[model samples]
Target chain A: MDGITVLIISNNIVLEKDIEMSADSKEKQLIKKAKMGDENSFESLILGCQGRAYNIALQYLKNEDDALDALQESFIKIFRSLKTFNGDSKFDTWVYRIVVNTCNDMLRKNNSRKNTDSIYWNDGEKEAVLEIPDSSNAPEDLYDKKEKRDHILSCLEKLNPEQKEIIILRDIHGFTYEEISEILNCSIGTVKSRINRSRLRLRETLLEQS
Target chain B: MKCDKTREMLSLYIDKMLDDNLKKEIEEHISTCNLCKKEYDDIMEIVTHLNEVEMVSVPKSFEHRLKNALQHERSKISDSKIIAISDKKKNKLRMLTSIAAIFAVGLISVGLYQDIIGGVTDQLDGTAQLAQDQVMQERVMNNETESDLYNSKLYKSNLDEAIDEKQKFEIKLDVADDVQSSDALKPRMSIYGYTDDNSEPGSTKALVPENYVDNPSVDGDSDGYSKDYSTMMTSEEFSRALTIQAIERNVAAVQFYKGLIEDNLRDFNYEILESDFVQAGECRFRIYIFNSKEGYVFNEEIIAIGKDGEIEFIYTNEFMGL
Candidate 1:
């Protein structure tokens, strides 16, 4: 029984490894075809990742139009830069890196375009930073799940872009420290420290809002 | 460790990133220290709330919109390439025309003015007409070649043919041990039980498993398929009938989906898992597996065979607000 159990475990391990290897190769094949200008293959390549990619953009940009624009622009950049992709990292990671960069660029451009003289919150501000809600009247217990979630999202939006991104990738999406490092093009140590700082900031914001 | 030091390391501790000794030290400190423990709890609570936030679904028109953008990009690339190729020809033509003009000037300078001027003018006119015809002919040829390229290497059909030649279906019903419920947190709309009345408008009505329940409300009759679909057929029988009906209507789409799966998961064999006829279209289900004997659900790709017989990715169990 012990021998049979061992054999079964080993077989499962082998099976999993085989699946992983095949999946990686399949992506590589798609990348190669896309590089050679097979438009359909390129479409197939982005199809699986596009949903998550768009979500990431939405989280960063915080609007449907901006998110969709960023996604479209990112895919176009990916399509153009297919040849430059060295296969040093996961294709999904590379796509994500482009997306993050594009979103950051757009945000910067928009900020510059909508420059204001005052140092305080400008056009994009949802509400006053310290304008605490009437929590005494409607206590925390009264707020439903959706209201709580909305409150959290609103607080999340208050953080700096980098902090918001770190929280989004680490806490929300559940990407590993290593994966976050690759996507953000930062060190794993930086990812760790950044995650801690971001979480602390979020906690502070949540506390303030309540 | 001091409270400040412990506080700094608490996030990493929650994430389980520190080495064994450091982790043990942090744990020991947090146990004794109230301030550090409170800090740890706050961060952990924030992390928990963040994790509970659901993933956003792409807009309904995103895929369609992106495809158009990709096509536009492809045309741009083709147009640029065409321009590059014509640049060399254009340069050569410019040089030849310049030479002709220079020769005409030389003739005029030699005082053969009226005698050769008319002939020269006629020759230049003829050359201009020829160049115009050549440009038109090249454009037509280029278009024909482009169409031929598209027709011959129509990627989906090519993939289908290739897979059909090299592969055979290695499908099985064996569920893997690691097949956890993907939608455990959300209320599920299974054939057995649907606890939530807040089902989104135009979302999937029901996801029939092996033991399909015949609930008229869950049957998706309102979406305008045959009313008796769920009552009459088992999931497999229904899928088979739908596949046949879909093939009869749109053979290319069936082939396209087959190729897509094969392309998506190359050597990873998949089986047609549980399928349902839902929402005016046949919902085809597929799962990747390890082997016939000891297979598990690696990925469950639910494809909706559309009203036009095109394969659309349903992705989630429900469409989730399109």
Candidate 2:
């Protein structure tokens, strides 16, 4: 989950140029049917968002099982309460809000259990014996690159959950301020303020680590 | 803008949420103000790192699990609709109808409006739909409550006969006599119903579900068996069948639902209650009671057995008063 997020988020640089609203006419039609208790329609409506939902949960939980658990929980809830979506807001935002809530629920539950804090490097076992020979740089340079990547991730998990979500949503996911506000259920002003504050916190953490 | 004002506006300007004029003004201020400029550089670096954060691919199994869960919820909803047809109790039917109506009201405008709105769907158009409905109806009918339905008798079982006339289905009437669940808006008046405590979780004994019996293997096992629950029927092990699946399915469905609608109820333990078989027309079902096993609130979960004997959560309503 750690390295995977970097791969996907780095490639999603199209956010600046992509301005299409959440659901297309076809999706909107499906959404309508889904709201009418059509399971097939509901499945179609959620098909696209599932990947993003998984990504968000992965970023939040940093554990694969927890991420999937959050997603399963969120989708079930979404299906149950599809009736609550009144088209007042974008469907994507509604889905994002529920994903956030589900992640929060998982976090709260896991925190309550308080059994152990296990740091899992996803697929670490398979990658541990890797031999990467880059054409552009020496192995030492690549090692430094890997180190820096890990360092950034290490700093990320240090922030509190609110700061973590704000950074991920705004900077990594490149969601618009308005969209983030809707997702977080905050005002545009709050989104801006919080993003800045989160950025400030991350900066401090990186500086301290350095 | 003053330095303090400029500091706050910097974020908005960078995010493009601010006007051009203000952005220019802030840009000018940062040009003259080295301290502010350094602060902005630090913030920009943080944003760069944030953007580098990777996107993880969902594991192959995630889709598998999600589809399974959706199928599970679909079955539950379909089960609920069947309950509407099978349960002649006016109060219970009213509750189910309102639940359906509430969902419709919450949705933005939708089509197929007539089928699921106002009343139970009596004549669903498709064969698949009718087949499924008929299957559910048959299950409910097998519960052996046919005579009671004809006599206009309540859902009073021998559990009721053994206790007393006043104590039929005593759990709701007795244990539910408390403040309504915090989620319910209206304060509910308690009507004492059935209450029999079966708090010991059988998760210890039925380590594997009763229906999940071993299938004879092709000489793979010394016991010549491998665990398979593909075909589970209620009539085989009626009591064991309903309680286990009901507990598992209800918990999973509720957790899924609680996540979707943003409920803040903390995770609580589930206590299995006694189950009874009841029938109406073509549908036969086992009604199971699963209250909050311990601590926090007076919520009661009632689930039912489907035609194939799979379990589905009906509703979790609170009884108030006292």
Candidate 3:
């Protein structure tokens, strides 16, 4: 029985690796075609990464419209400058970097014209930006899960942008430290320390919110 | 390791990023230290919850909007490329013009500029005017009377106003040398047929009707030079001149011939996206007709008009990506 279990585990690892290799090769093919001005290839290339990109934008901006704007702008910048992408880093890392930079630029631009009327800021100085979900109509287990999720997300908003960016990149998006380093254009050591500090800051925010 | 050091490396410990010895040491410290263990547990729980946080999927309209945005960017890049090519050509022309001006000034200093260049220009003008007068005299001799000249079967006009205009135009050129004199100042219609000297009579070629006076400074006017005699032409004559230039030479006039081309293509439902002269003798135009409700270009055609009034398809492509 033990021998059989070991064999199955080893086979599964090989299968996963094969799948990853195929996916990477396919992405490389798409990037090559997209660089040569194939619109369909470009569309296909961004389709896979756009979801996580949108989510990152949404988390940073805390507004759907602003997130969408950032996504559209980032995609355009990516398409226009696609030839400059040398493929040193992963495609998705480059995409996310552009998205993050676009969002940062928008945040800086809108800082002076900040919309104080956001629903996130509606509950006065003490209240968290996002309200806890109305769990009364939901199943007890489901509602509990949702409340915890919302609470954590709201607490995420309370962190500084740097802390929030690192947490979202590491914990939420599941980018490895090396990938995060590439995306953030920092050393592996910096990414590690930043993630550690960001996670600690996030923990403090979550505790304070509860 | 103490509790503080263990806490500092707790996130990395949970991530399994610490080296083997450090991982072992942190694990041992956390096991012995209750405070460090609690901190480690809290951080672990937060990371777990963060990983479990529901991600926002893009709206349904996002891909479509992004594709449109990307298409727009792609078009802008292509337009900039076209502009860059045009600018490069303009820069070369400017450099050549400067060189020619310097050469002309040197000729002026040597007192040979007027004798050589001016004498050639005057001779060319005289020869062109002589050719026009001879053609006019031959037409008068063939008709036998001015009224018969107007009534000749050789002249075909779909519109009555066009016939009246042509008759008035011929009379004006025949009676007045001043009108003929002004021909040098006005735009000269240099017409060429699509068929080359070697090409068979029925074979399709590019019809070019170009204006040399528009850029008379350029010396390399390879457009076949059939001079138009009417100095001050009407818009109707202008249109006919352009169309005849296409039929005569296979090249087109200047950019304003767009309206005339559109009018001629009114029978077809295709919209002219862009029209351009491909070469000295070839006219190439991108035309499209939308088929889908979404308004994507379904059928695209690039066509050139031959001298014999035949339409030659240069390219017929379906499913042009917007």
Give the true-structure RMSD of model 1. 39.1
* lDDT on C-alpha atoms for all candidate structures: 0.62, 0.55, 0.62
Model 2 lDDT, residue B230, Cα: 17
Candidate 1 C-alpha lDDT tens digits along B1-322: 7888887877889988889999989989989988788888878867777788888888889889988998898899789768754753564455456546655654554453343435434544554455445545655766656333323323223332222211111001111211233243113423212222365433333332321222222322122222322233333553465466444433433443454444333333457564444454344545534421112123444444433323454563221111
Candidate 1 residue A191 C-alpha distance from true site, Å:
1.9
lDDT by residue for model 2 (B63-130), tens: 77777888887899788667643542443354446546545543422232232332212221232254
After superposing candidate 3, which stretches have Cα over 4 Å from the reference? A1-22, A115-143, B101-322
Q: In the order shown, what is each candidate's alpha-carbon RMSD?
A: 39.1, 30.1, 21.3
lDDT rank order: 3, 1, 2
Q: Candidate 3 on B1-322: residue-level lDDT in tens?
A: 9877887788889999889999999989988888788788888877888899788789999877876777787789789778755754564465456546655654554454235335434545565455445546757777556444333333212122222222233333344344453363233221211233366543433332232223321222321221232333434554464465344332223232344345334334576676666564445566665332211223545554422222344454321211
Worst 10 residues of 2 chain A by lDDT: A120-129
| DockQ of predicted candidate 1 | 0.17
Candidate 2 residues A25-55, lDDT tens each?
5667777788777778887778778888888
Q: At residue B123, what lDDT does model 1 achieve?
A: 44
C-alpha lDDT (0 to 100) for residue B252 of candidate 2: 39
